[model samples]
Target chain A: MRTERIGDRGDLHRLAAQGLLYRTGPFVIRLQTRLREVTDTFARIYLGTEVLEDPRLAHFSVRVTASSPLRRPWGAQSQFWIDDIPPFEPYPRTHAFPLLEWGINWCIGTRAHRYLLLHAGALERGGRALLLPAMPGSGKSTLSTALAFRGWRFLSDEFGVILPGAATVAPLPRAIPLKNRSIQVIRDFAPEAVMGPVFEKTRKGDVAHVRPPHDSLARQLENAAPGWIVFPCFRAGGTTAVRTLPRSEAFTRLAQNSFNYRLLGERGFLDLTALVRACACFSLDFSDLDQAVAVIEDLASSA
Target chain B: MSSHESAALTAWRQPTSVRRFTAEQWTDALWGAGQHRCLARLSYRIEDAGCANACPEPAWDLLTSARYYPNFLQVRVAREIRHLHRILRARGIDFVLLKGGAYLSAGFPFARGRGMNDLDLMVRRSALGEAEAALRAAGLVTATLNDYDQHYYRTWMHEIPPLHHPERGVEVDVHHRILPLTSRLNPAPEIMWADAVALPATPGVAILSPPDMLLHTATHLFYDGAILDGFRDLLDIDSLIATHAIAPDYWSRLLGRAASLELGRPLYYALYFARRILATPIPTATMEEAHARFAPGALVRPVMEHLVTRVLPPRPRAARAAPVSAWLLYLRSHWLRMPPGLLARHLGRKGLRRFASDSPAADWPPP
Candidate 1:
């Protein structure tokens, strides 16, 4: 059998024509790109993952390539495509890898209504999941990455995929996108963390991706019941403060943080209510990574 | 219909076709339904038949994703209607919801996948300005348009230029009449509201009466020319017929209402095409009467048949439509929309503006 990994083949034309399927969670994205950086980035981040065979229909067929130089020679651009149609304006050529990552995220966030998709980071301990729901710049990613490298298995750094009509969350562990200073934070916090090359000067300034541990990738099929919900906030120099949140307040905050909460209508309301009822909810404010990790670990153990 | 053509349509009209669908056939049907923007309706139809459990992965994926947006819109439309009703009740502006808003308000089966670009509500022309003021006070404002465009809408269009909520991104179109004021056949708005039916869910909102609703749908499709939504409109007609034709006197009432509205010709075409294309059940006597009373002249009838059939169904993925047919219908729509002198001025100005815009850019770094 031909192995799922790309192995040694790195030719752009051949990859685009043949198509490479990267299975992520419930979705298998058939990605085709003529940009060298995008293929290289995909190869690096999705290092040990299986590549699905040809002729199997993918959930999303996407591509990224350079914009025509003749149109605008001043600045090179790369466009992301979904099913042959570009849904967004082209970005600078150096942003192709992030563009691809974001485009796939967009595809899942918009299309996958079978689950209640929250814009939150998730981690698992002893088959129990912890949902860290917060808006951007809330340090959810930083804490989740630290926990993933420490003892907890990473479920996902972006989406908290809670299956509709159930409380269990399916693991979709992919690369953790570390932004700006957090890139160095993770490197120093967990010296064993394997990360990719940093790409700077693009949107979401100075980003790199941390490779998910081999054990997390090995157990991608595992589904864990959500045990706790933490609303994390990072203050630069504040002491650690954790408070129990009322279930009703947690439900409202979670729905506000979800991508498809309103889209799922009554099903979303009922499912989220059930999830909030099952899990212990908290609001944590901390400045130190070690303190935040220790507090979260204690909470998970008590739950 | 050819055997190949019937494969897709058959899948749409009957649920059993889904049970027997090969993987390729299922993929093609899903693709065709998506192209026609009727996947939500297809989802409901298949689920009703208990075929959802057996759907192939690709079909299941398409159906679930397709169903969510329409369901979301359904909730939004309801909320928007309630907001509008609260705002307009004190002003005594009686408004009747139309199209998707109407179907959803009345809880019709065809409302399943009927996504709408705007919420359409028709008020009496005398009350139009008050209704506009009410919507404005409720935070719905019109998009900024140049003077000439504003003049065109205020002077000739049936509705005020569309209103949109700035923060919510929800569009609401308030209409005083159904057709454009300058169209060849103008149905009086009073006749429609005369027999309107109130929606039980909301106090102030109503829908056109059953017969008037059918006539309005046919006139809108035939006269306004809905190319992208042609299939959905036909499906709507089929659903309407199926829902309402059980009354013993419905056919005669429908014909009489169409005649009274000066819309017999459009109704005749709607019935003819609905029956032929979708296998919509039409009584033999009704079909015979429509043919005798409202069939077009020989030359126009054959030309319309060729163009309508070719252009109506969602074009299959591998198929190509005849360009001349679409072009002829385009001209026909404009001709039906306005008189010759106004048509010439409108087309001339539009063409000149398009030409000018297509010319080379003046310089880089646009202000």
Candidate 2:
């Protein structure tokens, strides 16, 4: 099922240009593209990721193809497709990397109903998983990436995927995308980490992707048990504090933030109830990344 | 036809045909079945054949997930029906469920994990206004449509514009008749209501009786000319026949119902395509009798056979003839519903509107 990353740059571009099969945490994706921007960015970010040997069964297939030349005179545009159907409109030709990233996320969130998917950033410590679920402007992504760089094994900075009724969370780590002000915060906070180029004026303001730790991809298949659930809210100049949340409140908030909670029905409810009941739930309000990590570190070690 | 594309149908028709599928074969089957919107049905057949556990990773996950989803929606659909049932019953209005909702509530095994776009119900034409008012009062919101569309539906179409229950996220299509009022044939609603049966569990909620159910499925499939979803519609017809075949005199009752309602043409096409495409079982006598009574003229029969043969396969990719078939089918459907002058006027207006393209893709964070 595995082979070393498809040789060097030429081979990578050649295969992906036609079409190539790559494994992404339990699901196999077949990507086809010819654009240099897409191929180059994909190579850099996915260097640690494996491209599968032949005899493949892909859960979803994507093709990032250029849109009509005339549609955008000043800048070329590219559209994302699964099979032959376009799920979203075209993105700037330069911004194809994040388009690919979030396109895969959309497919997983929409189609992968086998697991309960929480809209949370997940990291693992001491064989247990930490989930940071929050609504927009909650500083979850910035905080999760901060934790990952500080020796917490990264699972994902997006989907916290748990198999229904299982105690462990599956690893689906990818490049953590830091948007707007969080981009600069992460750059200053984690100077040692590898980062990708930032594309300006994306739908969500400026965006850049931080390559996950090498160990995260190496142990992508590993699963961790439930340890903590933290809902992080970033408030500039505010004090860093962690308050315990009742399991019931955690379940409700988690479901509201979940990608497919309603779609999974009873199984989602049961699986989530079990996870929340087994874990320590908290709402963290922090302005300083260092203090936030410290508090979460204490909770992780306690579990 | 590609051998890969045939895997799902062959497996569905004969579950034991292939016990294990190679990765490539699985990809082909997945693509084919997905195009038909029969992934859940395919999954059920695989599980029933006892091969689901033996299947490789991701394949099993994909199947179980697709199948489980409809069951989840099934719960929501039932709740929505109950909500609608109470609303209409309190206002002393009687209604019967139309398609998926009826099939689900009527205890048909084929409907177990079937995914549907919207829940459909039909109230008496006399009570349409009152039912609409009661539904609006009950907090079912209809999306804002333009004044022209509002007039078009209320004046010409059999159904009002769809109503969405904001809380449950379910769309309800309240239809007053089986076909459009302007259609070539208006199957009497009173004849249908005579045989409606209250769901055993939901006393006030009702579904069409078996013969009428078969007739409705046939009429909706052929007259609606839903060629894009034709493959799944064929599966529904096949399953309905298979389920009802167990009952004594079922085929004759269905034929008699179609004849009395002047809907024999659609019933004949439904049986013809179901048998040809899905290999649905139809008694020899029944097929012969239907052909004699309702089959099209000699010239048109072969033409239709050519088109449906092209349109109804779950082809891995659409064949060259697909668009031609779909175009003809689209026109046929409109012609079946409206007189020629009205049809032309309606199509011209709708075509003009397409000069302005469809709404843009939804913003991210939602998808």
Candidate 3:
């Protein structure tokens, strides 16, 4: 069967208003919106994603729209709704696309307990996954985007979606959001990267999105087993350093970084423990994006 | 509302019927149950009915993920109760578990996936002061500190303002009665206390008798609960009857208890809708007797049926508000809760506050 990819911006608008279901790894996200910012950016970023024609189960049916049906010209705000329930306050109207991205991520972090959702950036090579689990502002997204340009299949820049029992991860390669300084840093790092309009003064400061390589988005369903876990940190004007981590420490850190570790209870513990035990672990700190990418690539090859 | 999902909601009581559902229909089942906050319970039914394989992989993933939520709630309830138990035990006071907490403590199998946002327990009115002091000393903050809220809970409401456990994020509601004291129908708490059943597993904890439990469920559904969105409460009534009404004498006992408690009206509504909507097995004799004894007057019956049936079925996503009937039912619930004069003053104050803040959707939108 031929897969139906999204067409032009006008075509995207119609499908979204009528409710468009698109596959992103294990999730069938039903997205509906009239906000041009959302539809416009979504069309550009999701070029290779499969849009399901049949009306079926969607993990979330979300709509991005103005707070009120009647728009305010001077200071309009856009809200994100799952079904009819708006989970958060609205953002500035100009920030609709970013709000849509964050809104869907919120749905996954809060509800998708079918997998062990690690708060990490993941990329695959030779059917083996390298996990870059880190806290926010630690250069996880920047490094993952850099790696994708360097021939690694991007799994996700926000989530390491590990299916329990099989201990394998399916791809969740949504757009990689580059915040603050990471924006210019990625442009310099990957000159040919496809980028979206940057919204000024978001909660996380100036933000833009870089679509993952077309190759990664095309092979989103290919699953990979955990082969390495690297906790990365970025510090300006500092030298590169790498240190191996013990299994026990890795297990604790990974669990702490999970979105639903406690909610999954015993099952989460077992999945995390098995993942840590099966993979080699390390912590890498680098001042340079190029150096950080090189160290990760070396680790990927050695593993 | 006439979509496949709305149609799927009609078969919610029969899990075996899931076998006939296509992948799309299973998706519909998930949305309705999720909207009602009954996903975990439906998951159990799917498994129990031996129809797990019939559920599509997509729907099954969500149902499986939903398991951890109620499981998390069960754990939180147990921890919070343990904290309360130690404090109240030091004061030589016992609390009667109500609703979700009661079902959980009693080990009811159907309660496995039930979600409880707050802990509900009842104590004698005299012990209210002592219970408040103990909880404060235990470091559970009183979330309702504003003068109006405090007055509302202390002076007239059935439960005092909720006490928040800062660590677990669970609030506790300590009740002296099932309905507001100022409400039109105030069942005697001492009478319920006389028949509370003690649990050996958790000493000093007891649940309402089965008959009282049914009536309480009915009253809570129609009288106190948020109107137009009591599908879960209806499911509770069905589950309660299925579990406890096995004995031949249960119906007679339930109806008799409703009379003694002056709760016949709520019970009539409960049984009427439970039968019509879910096809719950109510003995024909009980239905006839209930209608004769407690059915609403002719004028009110059609109005209530019109409003309730419209609201109970899940509305399609496009319709934002319930018909004007919603505001009417909401106002009716308040009217049922307190005398008209007091309700007028209270709603007047609240209406002004809503106008002030520009209602951000809601602080609580159903479940």
Candidate 4:
């Protein structure tokens, strides 16, 4: 009988390689990978029989160990062995990282006293957080990636943790996962951005993660008051324009797009309503990234 | 003391006695054998609880089985309702609670353990001003609409523009009627007033009678064709009936109540579907009698069949047939939910409202 243990940093690394242990907050994640291959880039995760409980501790700790390498033609597949766990079944393929991140978010979100975890990419500039929340393909990630590169301090690439009680956005910055052609686009645009190796064809086509600038990482503990709520739509070849939307309409749109708005029920509604009331809202339609980034920067600077 | 004595002596040499364990004891022993299996298998996991804190063993363990999402939501909604009640009372405006909050106040447990979407309430037509003002005073901002549109909502729609609280992020739909913007079954608002019962669980928040609540749930499910997270609502109806043990006479009283209130259509739809889908124990004779009086068979059967197909369509497949069939079923269901006459009237009114807004006569009374 294989018994898993959570002892030290080395043990944590060993378990992470096996795909059985997940680290939450200092970051948030919902990781599920097999440990078939091990490398500097990929560690083999192991499964262990351990139950850890600590409040001031990060959310979610499951032990796993690395096994052997999973062979793939495109690249050496670094696999983590996740024993006694279920296989990874993610939607759109590349969504594995986001799903894991969301799971970690669920952990911390469930514990907060005043903040609510919202599904949106948050970025801070000039002491204010600009929330870009939208459904998939709504160009939120792309816009967030662009804005972060252009010096809008990245608060989070996913999840806008709205602290309506304090009227602020708490920062939980981590690796921003960019998918498909957008990956290359960001790489070319930034030129100096630190990004992870591109993993092809697991889920959510051609996925890669870009590490936030060191400055942004350093400021991860900083909080920004939410200043603007923008619903971004990416239309190829369309002119970039920002239109002020009615607060009421924006409220409705935000409610509809939220993952746990209904789950939070009346409080969720009231919290979101307060958030929109305190913030200016707009609908931005743009095909050009540079123009969008400039307008966002200007907006942030003004705020 | 021959062969038997020899055997007994051999058994005694091994052990004096071997206790035979019962099935229950054996099960307990088995469970105790595993290291973490007992702890892991102690409770069923709720997939959508939305808590991620897997530390602070006691807190994490409590949250793991705590029904925290709905419980947290219930507390939040209760607080908001208390605030809303204060505002309404301060202004001397009367209000009636509806749906989830209403159910909670009536001790129905907030949509059978699932969180509700928004707080629903009804204010009298004459007191819309007082109600709106009260909500505004309570920090709920009303959505600004164009003057004409605002007038339309006030005049024809069942509710005012949903009022939102800035910090709470909750929407409150203040309604004057129970049905659609264009439904023929216009029940008198006063009827709900007569049967309205104060929530036993929460003071100042009034809930509809069991029969009315049941009818409301059914009408909502059948008429609106809005079935997002409706399984929870259906479960509400089931629990309400089972717990109340509502009598057979209740159905007849409901039918009479519907007729007097001029809500025959909504009532008929509710009873029909409640019996069909939920297997609510209404007497067959009552259904048959109502069927004869309402004569809904001509329209109801096809509508129900269409809805049944749409709501529970065949599983998706690789073949084109499945997709095509689903599309057709969806169209059919939409048509059934709204008859051609109602649909035509709705579309026509919408078009007229959009294109021509100068004439006061253009504003038609709600169907």
Candidate 4 DockQ vs. native? 0.06
In candidate 2, what are the lDDT values of residues B94-180, reduced to their tens digit?
889988898887878888668877899999889999999999999999998888789889998889999987988889999989888
**Residues A26-81 of candidate 1: C-alpha lDDT, one tens digit per residue:** 77778887777777767777777777766665677788889888997979998988
Greater DockQ among 2 and 3 belongs to: 3
Error of 2 at A117 (Å): 0.6
lDDT of 4 by residue, A262-291 (tens): 656556778888899889898888888889
DockQ of 1: 0.36
RMSD (CA, angstroms), candidate 4: 17.2
Give the Å shift of residue A153 in candidate 1.
Answer: 1.5
User: Please, what is the TM-score per model?
Assistant: 0.87, 0.93, 0.93, 0.48
Docking class of 4: incorrect
List the DockQ of the predictions in order: 0.36, 0.65, 0.67, 0.06
TM-score of chain B of 4: 0.66
Name model 4 segments beyond 4 Å from true.
A1-303, B1-66, B109-112, B144-152, B200-205, B264-278, B298-303, B309-367
Query: Candidate 3: which stretches are off by over 4 Å?
Result: A7-10, A34-40, A66-70, A75-77, A301-303, B1-5, B22-27, B316-321, B352-367
Residues A89-164 of candidate 3: C-alpha lDDT, one tens digit per residue: 9899889999999999999999999898999999999989999999999999999999998888889999999998
lDDT of each: 0.83, 0.83, 0.85, 0.58
2 or 4, which is superior by TM-score?
2
Find the 10 residues in a row with the least total lDDT in model 3 chain B. B1-10
DockQ of 3: 0.67
Model 1 chain B worst lDDT run, 10 consecutive residues: B358-367
Instruction: Say which prediction, candidate 2 or candidate 4, comes out ahead on lDDT.
Output: 2
Model 3, B1-367: lDDT tens digits are: 2352253355466778777776566666676677877888888878888888887777788888898988888889988888888889898889999999889888888887888888999999999988888888888888647798899898999988998878978889999899998989979998899989998876788999999998998999899855567887888899999999997789999999899889999999999988977789999999999999999899999998888876765543434546577767777787899999998998777777788877843423433
lDDT of 2 at A55: 74
